[model samples]
Target: MLRYSNRSIFGIMEGATVFYTVESNNVTNLHQFNQELRNLFDRLRIRAASDGSSRKFAAGNSTGPYPATIYALMQCTPDLSKQDCDDCLVRVLGDIPITCYGKEGGSVVAPSCFLRYGISLFFEPTDDTLQSMGPPPQAVLPPESNGANATIINEKKRNASRIATIMVVAIISFLILIIYICIYLRVMRKPIGNSETTDVSSADSLQFDLGTIRVATNNFSDANKLGQGGFGAVYKGRLYNGQDVAVKRLSKNSEQGNTEFKNEVLLVAKLQHRNLVRLLGFCLEGSERILIYEFLPNKSLDYFIFDPTKRAQLDWARRYKIIVGIARGLLYLHQDSQLCIIHRDLKPSNVLLDAELNPKISDFGMASLFVLDQSQGNTRRIVGTYGYMAPEYASHGKFSVKTDVFSFGVLVLEIVSGQKNGRFQIGENTGHLLSYAWENWRKRTSSNIIDPIFKGGSTTEMLRCIHIGLLCVQENIADRPTMASAVLMLNTDSLTLPFPTRPGFFMNKFSESYKESSEFIQASANEASVTDPYPR
Candidate 1:
């Protein structure tokens, strides 16, 4: 009965606001506060996961410093069953710290659930709430017996005691049997390696044999190859059913290829959204590790947006759709997916275009998952392409949801200008796209950055997007808007945008240092860029 379309269904769910911190009191002992919050989330997770999970909602408070208690309320969408609700809510609530940790009051809203916590009450305490639910009922007690009835009761009681003793013995015997069975199974299963094979058992039904894929791509002939990246080559294929698919064959020589291959196979399998590339199946036999995806005939956004001839075909209307589509897709990854994932590598080439020109995010080899309430993560082994990497992530290896915002900002500017952000020039200004956009906006000549392909499109929209892109790339991570907010800024015209300060790598001219910092990222770059492309 559901007349669902990918774009339509995606539009409906992409707007869900996942996690947010309220702008209230800033707790001084952030570490202690976070510890208490995690304890509370675990409690709720268990309560929601158990039987009688219909309520799928609970509220409680945890003690911090004296007179400083954190009051929290968590609830999942009523329609979701117990397990799904528990999973969705716990994941959504865990990102609160990254969104707003020190704040006294904040809320996270998702399509499945909404969580709010602070030093105040956001919802009325229900006596029948989930936390109050308890164990099985007892049989009604009989009225007190006396005289002749007392004698009969004593006789019955003696018999009842005998039956109860037998029942207890039988229950204990069953428990022992169950325990022995569990131990035996545990020992038998302990030898499985904690690697891709173990993690992807759930994907067994979807795995395609190498021979099947070989036939589909005719042994991965060069002519069938779509494009090559740092990790592997993608080939276009057709199954026996006549369904088109994209096959990614990773190079064995690459050091991180196996890890990335396994990660994509596991991570992409759980994510189902309109803007994401669907993983039809995977092939992992012997040394070969291949991933299959829905074939996108139009190639990638970079193939067109950076090409002069193809650029003209994407007028402002189409460009704007691409921008919005990218935003919604990022929103799904950051807030709406099964896990809080940071797509460390986000660039034009990673965005593929379908026949309808709708964008589907691709290449998840560099992505990372953030545990509940964990905002930013550090990495000594820096990854992601240059030009789009956030300053914190690129330099010190700190990345969070805001990192994606910065990349999205770079993408917006690239889409609007139909030029690569790494080497962009406007008249006398020869610097990175961010510098050019900032200078033009400040000089009241922002229109100079707009692509000539859009002659009659709305100037206001283009200007607004440029403004948003700048906000995303601000040197200060806090200044960047969350994807939910970014989507609002793009779709809702009335929302006002804050002025962006000097972005990272801001410059007046094409200095050698600037060139080094703004080098165009080739498809062959590793997980992260170690230095400027044109290092002086």
Candidate 2:
């Protein structure tokens, strides 16, 4: 049996409470890449629901996420499904005092569920009650003595001085150890590929000559420029076969682009999916590296979703179709494809619509893939836009298939509301659109969450879609439904959906603070400032 202590530290110092888990088996579903574990947990927490029969988060051993043989136990209240468990956790994070406030070993037992962690060993029973290991051990000390031996005292003083000197050296060594630990943790917390690791993989592929691309793009003239990204600019060109293609030219100073280019070629070249953008070929000449892709007539999903005038062209019917199409595309990446990919930077900008209005998911430069059986992973650095990112992933560098689900949830909400989640503004409160929507949902006023553009559409369909979106953005990675379930929910009207508790990143105090700010007034006065928070 493991001997654990129950004694609390006596000091003003607060006990450290690390938000992490230790699996009995090393076989964690979370891959140690791109914060996949954090993303997966956020997705699961949000997708679980408590509605009768069809609760998104079932409590039975056989239910919940993955399989029981996997020891998959989600600890929400009995009344709450896995989904409810996730919602409460999301909210609880906000409730944790701005300044730390909690016992060394204590729990917050909500009416529906309980959140806990303790210093002492507790029994892992399937209930709320905890079985403490026992009382703490008492320390044994040297006995007191009379002043019968002044000589002994002098000898003891010399020994005491030596011991103090040794202790000081030990303390200095301990401090150094702590410093190293902190440095290691900080390094581990950074995103996987930073400037230091510039060389990604550069597997041999169908290469193009720089002279060939330069002639095709007319030496990359301004007229040839198609679009611009963080790494480089894209240019339009015609290949030898008279095929129209897009050429991405990396900037001379861009280290990230160089790494991404190599990574994309090595990973995406072998992947074949309808929704994924096709990489026809690439070029690698001295001081010149370019990627060639099949160019789509329409640019990206954001150009339509966020532009009011252009958005009008995408009527509810068309937008709805686009939303479902993207879901199908994601399903292909996550499940139905040859590789189980998690698009770390999924957003409107990453999605491209073809001339026929068919949606294709693009931008594999920041994507991560895992084995089909794996469910989650972690990262050191967190990328992606703020509003679209799930809380778990943003805060803890965890991600997985479920991480994509959280991004998809944000996408679904944006689609239905015709609002940019990253830049949504309501009345005086400024918060993530997902959180704003959640507040309205809890008040049974989700109808108000719909976009004014779709004022005359079907309320039932809109409501259902909103419900589904909320489910996608749940707090727990396990609670979020799979892409398979999301596709089914969107395609099938017969399926029932449970109430959504809330999405992640709902900072109540921050919203309140923004509501009372003068900057908000300035933003409110300018319609342009009322932009979507998401970087579409």
Candidate 3:
């Protein structure tokens, strides 16, 4: 509960009297002047509405003879309402300064009424009245009341101190609990032998804000969607500082897939090369696992080399650069880097191109890390793209650096012929690009193997790339040329090309299977189509 008090004073400065008097048209209109006077006093009633209080006020004036003037003012306590409002004002007005001996000036100011007058105009304009007030008289109390008030004030101070102390303790307790929970989760979440951090640069290097990532990809809108893969959809994003980025967000339901995710973050963090796609930063917030990479404008090699219209833009010169770029990238991954890495899913689709059509080996999702001295490894699951998989790797689950060489060989042939390795079909060849290329090479009609669209391209250069491709697709892993040697042979004119032997696991009956498979796919598609039958 709260209490309030108020007071006001009024006075006038005068010298001489004026002879003019205010004259209204009718005597009954005197109520109009009284209403205006009441309205003037109403302003003080609504003054303290903000503090949830009610008020009322009233006032009156009298003009005597001898060219005298009259002034009147009125106000009410803020804690009063409408009826109380008018009643309080009327009471104050009834006790006007009639008792004060009339001389030249006088004033009447109570808890409500406050008026003043003189012989001349005491205020600025005739229609306007001054709304000024003096400060209220300070409240004073008896000794006993003062003692009780001091005690109550002291009690309030003590209560405030106690509340502040409790609030501080509660805040500290909450922070400590949060720290402990974080530590427990960190310890329990990590897989055995996993490192706490992938980089030694700084603890905050990989940290990304939620708002920052949202703004980068335009809140992950459909327009910024790059592509979808096994992990999740990739988004093309732009940061606040205008840095273009590719964001890979992992799917939550992907169970045993994060093994490669962790491998890539740790491996790429330590290694840096122009051929390898750069990892700008990473994020692990709540359920979000995002890997931010430098944006590659040209997209994947398959997007262009396999496309009918886009493939036209890639002449022999551009295609050769892409092939050599991929070789250099693979060479760095296999031998130059500290970790001996084998990209298990090396294919045309996995090789991304930059602005100048330079190939950068990407998609380290199925990558395997080998020790420096280790040469090979075998996996039972055998996870890889069907056509690009080497014969030994696909059938026996044996893979090495040479496994990637086999895929590279298939990519080379596809680039030259403008066809997919798996889509090759004639009579029996269905899942065989090497067999088709080798058969065309042996028939002395290798010119038929050149892409019909590249009819204007040099046959000599085309034959050279085809020959190198055959060498890389040999049956034995040892027979395949290393990426470094392949790059050197392609670049140098002085090196004598070696004769390629019988190709790896070439099935003579592929042409027959190809025909059967095509018929089956066609039949399946027809069965799936909704066709309306008409009676003949």
* Per-residue C-alpha lDDT of model 1 across residues 407-465, encoded as one tens digit per residue: 99999999998878776665555667888888888888889998877867679999999
List candidate 1 stretches off by more than 4 Å. Answer: 1-199, 254-264, 366-372, 427-429, 518-524, 528-536
lDDT of 2 by residue, 1-536 (tens): 00112564221122122222222332233223112222333443443433432323321111124222211112343344444455655543322221112222233322333233323333232211111112334434454543445557657756765664476346434544554575578667656743223224224324566756775798899999988766578999975435688898865653445455565565566557677788777776666767788899998888987887888878878878888888887887777754566776678877888888788887665333333345676766665665666778778978777778888988888888777775466556556677678888888898877777788778888888888889999997778899999999999999887766657766564666434532332121110000001100
TM-score per candidate, chains pooled: 0.60, 0.55, 0.57
Of the two candidates 2 and 3, the one with more favorable TM-score, higher being better, is 3
Cα error of candidate 3 at position 404, Å = 0.5
- lDDT of all the models against the reference? 0.71, 0.59, 0.60
Candidate 3 on 1-536: residue-level lDDT in tens? 11122532212111111111222222233234433333433444344222343222222334323233344433344444545544544433332211222134444333322334333443322111222232334557777799888788668756765664576346434544554566577667656753333332232334455546775788889999999766678999876435688988766664334444454465565557888888776665566778788899999988987787899888888888888888888887777876566776777767898989888987654234443344677666665566676889878888778888888888888888887775455344344567778877888767766777778757887888899999998887888899989988888877888888777756454467654533332111111101011111
Residue 69 lDDT in model 3? Answer: 33
Greater lDDT among 1 and 3 belongs to: 1
Of the candidates shown, which would achieve the greatest TM-score relative to the real structure? 1
Top lDDT hit: 1
